[model samples]
Target: MSEKTSTTRRTMLQGIGASLAVGGFSGLTTAAEAEWTTAKTGTDSSLYDVEYTNAGAYAVGAGGVVLERGPTQWTKIVDGGPTGNGNSLYGSDVTDDGDALWFVGSSGAIGEYAVRTGNLNDHSAPMDNTNNYNDVAVTGETGSANVYVAGDSGKIYYSFENGETGTWNYVTPGSGSAIQAIDFHGPRSGHAVDGNGKVFATDDGTTWNPVGLQDANVNFYGVDSDGDGEATVVGGGGMVFHLAESQWTADSTGDKSLLDVEVEDGDGYVVGGGGTVYSVDTTAAKFDELAGSWTAEATPVGQNLKAVVRGPNGAPDVTVGAGGTVLEK
Candidate 1:
């Protein structure tokens, strides 16, 4: 097998039959929703990605497992057996209609699960088993819904029909690096970041071109848009790039590798290795590290966090590697 295939298989097998549990934290249950907490069916495996929906919050991780969080608590929806096989669900995005959720993982596994009907469907049977789907982005364009997925070996797949049933054609953006995350803020504007610290943008999601940054040593792991053609990309070595005036600007925090970033309430949060979290002041061009600032909030766990998302109330919800850790702050 090739290097890509070998890496993909190793990620999947390492997460198989792993136990997943939520512990080592407190204040999870509010007084009003205590009855809905179901802790018996938790998985001890690592959860790679998570997204929020009208139905609730869904998190996917190793071993093909899916967990759902309702108004009060979390419940396991799918188990690791023949279906999941411990494939690392690295990226996920919910549709605008709040009806469907799409996840991509190792071996090009593209699984779609319906939120209302509880239907789980897999769409990876066509690929040659060499592709590993890593990230997904949804576009709410008029008259046509588009979903783009990026993966290993410099592969990018797109679906115009919302990934229901259609040909997922591949597009090579000339990066020659694995696309780690994608974000579409509007119908015609979006951006994607790769492992080589490069950013690609497209107005129509069809024709993509590179947006040069002053520094190219930053390995961007996640990106998010503001629905106004502006975006922020975060990655390794405390690198943060923002799009303003049709140009990308670089800002360094002088910290460890940043794994993920998210924007909420006109503010941004960048999370990464060594319990590093930085909050960007949108009005300013730099990140402030003053005491008692939001960025100074230390992650309770120090296990190299992989992803972070802003909760409904703008609180930080984070996930880390190894031991299936989930942190809410």
Candidate 2:
């Protein structure tokens, strides 16, 4: 998802008081079970997003820097990535099989990296549009994943044939509001969020419908479209909005804007602000025994966090943020 919020929106978030915690999720343990560990990335460039796959943990950021987390440490695998012209990468996702990683960013820069190999496939600027891409989601195995890209111009550009040049198409979910994030749970089913407080879902990847977040005043920067009626949307003022079918619930974890989130299998992670990290338990909160499902964990840095993703295997969730700060929770 996109990293920086607009100046006008920032003011609105600061002025409007956040509401009480909303009802969602089941209770689960965090913080006590594990702590966040800052990994040394060996660079100071801001890291905007991270994705965990079977191949490894990869991060993309400023100047198109791509990082890989190994057994020993984090290393810069690519400099001036895909475009090789210093276009910052803002969003990324892995294929269903977790074999390839695709990233989208400034100047319509889009590229796919074979996780097992070092090969980078350039798929930038489909249809000759140079708009910035905020986020992306793929819904199939490597080499065949349907690529859905969320553009900052409030459009969704997609390709069914793995982003092949002529196979791409575009659709605007809202009235030209910048689409900050897009996530898919099936081959053609998923959700997206825009800068204008709009939430949209699509069953066929072309026709989008307003699913939730009705009359919202805050902008949503991230979305985890788990299923038809289940999603976690995070945005300004650390707000979290959850959709349980047609009902929508709202709450705030803190005052800092939540830039990104990922929830799956009843567990997830959220990150934002300077060193802000949240462990989300999507299981126990449904029982009403747990009042709030979010738990804040301490971090080792002060850089503004950008994006987060689930960990591979039994690894802790990985979050990337400003100044290239990476943390394992």
Best by lDDT: 2
Segments in model 2 whose C-alpha atoms lie over 4 Å from true places: 1-33, 285-291
| C-alpha RMSD values across all candidates | 10.0, 10.3
lDDT of 1 by residue, 141-241 (tens): 21245778887767678877756554556677755788888877655467887767677888776777887663667667888755343677777768777
- The residue pairs found clashing in candidate 2 are 25-285, 25-286, 26-283, 26-284, 26-285, 27-284, 27-285
TM match of model 2 to true structure: 0.87
Clashing pairs for model 1 are 19-44, 19-45, 20-43, 20-44, 20-45, 21-43, 21-44, 63-86, 188-203
User: In model 1, how many backbone clashes occur?
Assistant: 9
How many clashing pairs does model 2 include? 7
lDDT of 1: 0.61
- Model 2, 125-211: lDDT tens per residue? 999998999999887768877899999999999999999889999999999999999987678888999888989989898999998
